[model samples]
Target chain A: MFGTGQFQLYNPVRVIYGKGELKRSAEIFGVSNVLVICDPYVSSNEYFKEVMTGFNSVFIYNKIIPNPPCELIDEIIESVYEHSKGAPKFEGVIGIGGGSTLDTAKAVSSLLVSEGKLADYVEGKKKFEKRLPLMLIPTTSGTGSEVTNVGVYTLNDIKKPMTSPTFWADIALVDPVLTYSMPKRVAATTGLDALTHAIESYWATSTQPYTEGLALRSAKMIFESYEASLNGEEWAKDEMAIAATIAGIAFSQTRTTAAHAISFPITSFYNVEHGLACALTLPTLIHWTYKFISEKMDDFVRYVGFKDVEELAKRIEHMMEYSGFSLKLHDYGVKEDELEKIAKVSVEANIINLTPGNPKYEDVLEILKTIY
Target chain B: MFGTGQFQLYNPVRVIYGKGELKRSAEIFGVSNVLVICDPYVSSNEYFKEVMTGFNSVFIYNKIIPNPPCELIDEIIESVYEHSKGAPKFEGVIGIGGGSTLDTAKAVSSLLVSEGKLADYVEGKKKFEKRLPLMLIPTTSGTGSEVTNVGVYTLNDIKKPMTSPTFWADIALVDPVLTYSMPKRVAATTGLDALTHAIESYWATSTQPYTEGLALRSAKMIFESYEASLNGEEWAKDEMAIAATIAGIAFSQTRTTAAHAISFPITSFYNVEHGLACALTLPTLIHWTYKFISEKMDDFVRYVGFKDVEELAKRIEHMMEYSGFSLKLHDYGVKEDELEKIAKVSVEANIINLTPGNPKYEDVLEILKTIY
Candidate 1:
């Protein structure tokens, strides 16, 4: 039986998706005064020149680190104030990079209207009353942050996410041409990250019929074409781009279940890439989550062209290994004793309860040991 | 290759869906001065009493007939004026029945401010400047009319659909409990109607990845459980309700293609029920459309658990026959010579161009003859 649940969907973000739809950015973003947020790598690239063409005034903030810290956003907030001294007021923000860039853009948009820093609002000390409009052009396919209404930033030395409908972008230009420059290794890990989102969300306790449709299609697209995407098939890049955004829509409604809940501490403590950290635990998590709901597990395997859940997990592991995502816990500078602490931290995360039934601390510890 | 296309999704409708979500209608619609739209059968039901509970001024307009004509809508327009003589102006419209009732409600919402008649807006002579807030509680599983932005009404003696973004409902409270009392004959035809929507929309030339995901899942659900839903299975009723709504969303994005194009004349001329008319020719249309795109056909058959396109078509025919949807054109009072006009009129619909390739008038004629 399809579970009875109330799906509250209110995505007001307009999306313009195609191979070369970025030319319409000026029309979609409206006014000319805008802040362009990205990393130093993206600002140094050639496409940045085209992106800066339409705006009358553009403030560049390129200090975002991976798993972006709140202090970096505080610095950018200072930079925006510095640039606004003798110019027209900033009307919007344009984010054009990976997850951290988009997240920082969203955070900066929210902070401009609210009091204090980003942490104050995130920690419940303040609530934002309004926000600057946002438009995102993603250079990477992994984060799905362009469409989702959350920003993942490092807070108090651990990666924390702030969620509210105010963070959704007004326009997301998902041009596949922007993703061609992503490194092969980045492509693999991010593709796996999207795959994990689709799979974990398919069986989440709160998974509804609408999200199920998206999760199924995402799983089919990523599983069929991710390896080819790693090898740089042009069409596969487009499919992967669309698949990642679709997976984001799937999990954004239900939130991620087990694998995502378990990945935060690994990325924070060991400095593993966010997508890679999520990718590492996904195969084992799939094996574990399938034991709770066998029917859905069977459907997943059948739809993705596998005979059983074990085959599906092994396929994911093979894809990860082929793409250079195979590193032991020790490779990330984790000692043997650190595994238990990591497991405990993952269990304490609020998203852990979003999974089906009660996945005890003991269960997470076992899964960690197996992955290690 | 996944065809390069833009997925412009911006659904701002707040959907509160569950088993008993109709109780929150007062909160969602906001003001108490509301108009109730339904059929005679639905207005006499016990749930109609519950729908009228929290309204200070409520006007009931239950004169909507099947294959709804603009003349009847003109009468509804007059009745609404008749009721507004001494009461506070109706601030909102609450549509609580099948497709005709919901379409009438949406049409009334659009007509509140527009000059002249409904046909003027449909024919591009006038446009709706604003609409009354609409809250829809669907009592049938077919016609994804609740979430869509178009109202199908007969204009100038031909069934015409008025298209606009302004027609989308503010709130769609999809409660499956309201659908359990559907008669078996209604269940069969409407279930087939939804299945056709899913299948036809999947192959539309403008179909995007997101709508394809919704269409595929909807097709799977309706095809799998429609037979059981005809037998009055409780779980099947719930599945059909969700599937039909999902199909509505799928077709709403791209609109329906050739089968829907062909079915309109049958519905308007032969006096066949709207759903049943679409159901009549769907199987043969599936067989014909499959010959054009065999790879997608293979995927559709495999995913829906059929051996081939022919097997899928046969399975559809079997389901229709069991649901009492089998009848010849002659049985509906169409002479053999009328077949040419029916086929010619099907070709004239704007939606026929939405099909994948050039499906000529002769192709439609052959398919109609085979189905006949």
Candidate 2:
């Protein structure tokens, strides 16, 4: 009478975690020829040098911008084809930056073997089958891009999501050293994003036996380590790195629900950083979702050492504030009057279906108003 | 901060778990010309017929005996070669029975491509490199063999263990239906076996971030459901199946520690069933290990809803009694005089080195004497 569901969990990524994982990864992965995709900022970092040491020939594509555009992916694909001529075709693609770089690595790898424009796949018009062996090293703990299956990019000014079984990474080599030099603000913001990802996945309709424990443990780790991690504590940074990757694996198995859905429009229109935008609604949403998930809420609260749902929500709100996230929507360019439209966009986003109770648009409006 | 240890987590098995997972997995794995290994008992069962329909050609080798002997593996390898003469080499090895049957699958697959006797690998005298695609479907919920990397066999009267990265299964199609036919006693024994695997792995020295949560979660699932599962509850049977496999994955990554070490000789030298041997000393050992691990003990005891160690230990003892497992060594024809030798063999087993706090031989002897 037990396993009463139809769900599939396919996480093939080999995660090698420890203090010097990045340096040790090259030998473990054993690649002779590779393409290294990086954000402009990450390619200039010292850890990026260590990331490329054992490769025989390393082709660098370090121009990925946030919400990576189609033109850049096409350009990178052409460059990869030209560079691999006569050489052993690139054995793997190593994405060694933040979300954009990793998404580009996945998108570019899919484009290399499939027949279609990038937009067609992201827009869900075409299906892509081929994937390169991928080794993802996240420079930021926030995006969890290393382990997640989805490849998010901007298509005609809208962020379009694309993923296939092929987009799954073969290896996720997380090194805290990569995140050690992060600016305090970036560390705090991204750490909060990882925390929200864990919490939202815990509440998602698709949450199951496997994702449940990972999400709870991840949330607990981030709660205990995020502040210290932001303060550049080495141990906390290491914990956060693992926590973020685990959060990514959790949410990837069960895609994000309403928190991410509602945050999208705010990030799109208000120019708020994605992490901060997510943080703005997360605490109140937790309070609202508490009624629908009292059992899980109780377990998580006790496991994470919070007194109650209100206590948990207050702590998360405090975490956002300490992480330099703007709690009020008005702090960003959004007017108070725009709350209704934001709530409408969240309902239309269709992610609320992934929430357990399928929270109504009025509930979304109420949550927005409370946060505002 | 965080991770101060050196560890790796690599589990690539695609586990399709549910009531209909066995049927679903056939289409997903998409194989033909398979060698289906089974216990002679399982081959004669109705489920066995259903297991063979999707394949183009099925080769049956149903001679797996308990504590699978090295000679049996050699015989199977020869028969596999003879049966597939001039035909396609068996593309996949589908193991569908108890622990011995699945272990035989791994041993036969390992021997097919590597030029050596099976005992050589078990004795650590040879390393095999090639792997056959393997699909493991467990008929019994006890062994957790479907997901574990190691193959255990009898070598010169000792239960010798052999494992390689290549020994891992490509797919674990866990169907609770296969286990619904288990005799009540078999259910009790295998469920306890899974519980012990979970507990020992939770405390192994090699245990790291990924395995820790899985072990704890598996342990909790067993504790909550093993009794109901033994009482012929269908849902509990399904949960136990998943829990057992998860526990296998946990211990396979970190290896089992002192409890398993102690239990091995007891099982090998005595005629006791492996699970009963493990259950005989488990509760007292928990009482013993509690002194060495206050923080972890507190977490586990509270997480499982016990008020304290005393309560936890008592509940475990009650569980053993209820599961029809003999708690005293004397009841199984073991004299009190044998405790010292048993403890000596346990320490000499060298697996105690993997236990945190390094449990002493004297401590093991004391635990054995107390249980006696």
Candidate 3:
């Protein structure tokens, strides 16, 4: 009689959360030779050499860029082959940085072992059956790319998100100390991204009890720690670090909804930060999705210590303003005429259908117009 | 600064939850020939054949007894060898029953591939490196054995709980339909077990945010549905089944605390059912542990829809009374003088130290006397 609640929950990522965990990577990876993928900022950090001390041999590839392109990932694999003289000498792959760097690392790890360029796999022409032992460490509190089995790469100037069984890393080491150096603006934006993940996953039609539990706890923690985390409080950064990963795990099970779906074009066209772009639509989406999931959202608001969904939505806008972000699309150079195009693009991402009420193009355009 | 919150969360069990998930067991297991370990009651169940229809060949071993002893598990493995004509032909192992049967199945699956008797492993003489692909299904809403990597066995008439990495199943199929036929007594006891798991895991010193979230969600569901489930309501039973597995996942990470530690001797000496026995000390422990974790307990109580911790304790006692179970040890044939012995045995469990206040023998005796 209760068959409709059918769902599957599976995330095989071993998450090690704490401060000073970066140095334990070699021990957790259990490999002597490794390929390190990172942003240049990560490799230049003081702890970089300390983290690599235990490995017998290491090769650092630090050319990662934001919105990692398929060719960049292919270059990473090619560099590895050129460095190793075509021998599979690296025992594991370790990725350390923001979302794009980690996403690139996922592709590099898989492509190093399997045949083909990153574009082929990103386009769904090839399936990754296996990869080197992989571990991800996020240096930012936002993009929970460390825990999710998803990697979004830019293909032909378009963001393509794909999932593979092999993308599930063997370990996700969330050392909040790594995030301690995040500039205030980076922290603010990424913190918003994590908040969006928690809120969207909580109300997604695809959610079940396991993910709901995670989303509720994560959303509460993000709300508590987001402002303090951006203000450079070590303790708050620590909480934000853990909360973001928990939120990532939540959305990993029941992918994200409208906010993420609409964020693609907003970030692509307006040059808005990925997380800030996701958040621009959040307050509106929260209000929009409320009627469909009012009771569930009320449970969330109450559990997170909010008075109501209206207060919850207002609190999000308050956070953006506090972080010096304008909450209007016009402030980000998005013209009113472009709202329809953005709405069209948003509806194209299939995951938007997982949103409660399954907002169509007209609904999407109405939401965009309301926010604009 | 946040180093103390350091923890790891990893559970590789693929959980498929819904009604009639049993019929999809063959598809989820992804194997043909199978060995099923179940209770005799389960083998005779009307849906048993329907569950096994998709398998190429099946061996049903229905000798599971409560508090599964090491020798009995060894015999199940021996029977499999004899029946298969000395060839390991079964591709996987499926366990469908209550806790004892599932625990036996975990041991059998591990023993089938690794060398040595079950006693050797139970006694920590050997380690399990691998197991046949294993899937577990629960027919009762208590014990939560389906999602945990723990198995309790009787070695010398004493319940010895052990954990193994191999004990985590490849899939946990939670088909609530299987639990629809539970007698009121079984339902009440098992429902209490799930609640105890949720509460104990929440208050365990070893807990982190990930598990605390699950415990809160599961405890709330159990509170909302346990009474209806006891009344043979299908929807409530469905919630209970899902809640129990979620609680299992929570405790799988943190282990249980004082209530469970106190349960072993109570069940062993007085023949009280395991779940009911575990629950016997819960109300007292809640009050005892409150002072140490008052704020956290308050959070849990509030989230579970109770006014306060005292009210939560009373609610549990009320549930016991409603279920027709006496809350006193004397009614269960436990002697007044025996309270000290039970205290000693309870404190001896290493897990008792995980309790909030880390109660010692004297405190335990005081708790027992209070409950008495």
User: Mind giving the per-residue lDDT tens digits that candidate 3 earns over A286-354?
Assistant: 889888888778778878878898999899999999999998999889899999999999999988999
DockQ for every model comes to 0.55, 0.53, 0.58
Q: For model 3, how does the per-residue alpha-carbon lDDT over B137-237 read when each residue is reduced to its tens digit?
A: 89999888988999999998878889999999999999999999888999999999999999998889999888888998889899888888898888899
lDDT of 1 at A65: 76
Residue-level lDDT of model 1, residues B1-372, one tens digit each, is 573666677665666677766766787678888888889999888677878777787888887787588878777777778767743388898899988888888888878766688778778888787888988889988888888887878776766787776778888888878888888877877777888889888898878777877887888888778888878787788788889888888787888888888888887788777677887777777777766778877776766767888898888878877876665677677777778888999999988998877588998888777767
Query: How close is every model to the real structure, measured as TM-score?
Result: 0.94, 0.95, 0.98
**Cand. 1 TM to true fold:** 0.94
Sliding window of 10 residues with minimal summed lDDT for model 3 chain A: A1-10
lDDT of 1 by residue, A176-246 (tens): 88888888988987887888788877888878777887898888889878888889887888999998888
Candidate 3 or 2, higher lDDT:
3
- Judging by DockQ, tell me the better candidate of 1 and 3: 3
Task: Please give the lDDT score for candidate 2.
Answer: 0.80
Q: Best candidate, DockQ-wise?
A: 3
Give candidate 2 misplaced runs (Cα > 4 Å). Answer: A82-89, A113-116, A124-127, B87-89, B113-116, B124-126
DockQ of 1: 0.55
Candidate 1 docking band: medium
What ranges in model 1 sit over 4 Å off? A3-6, A55-57, A74-78, A86-88, A114-116, B67-91, B113-117
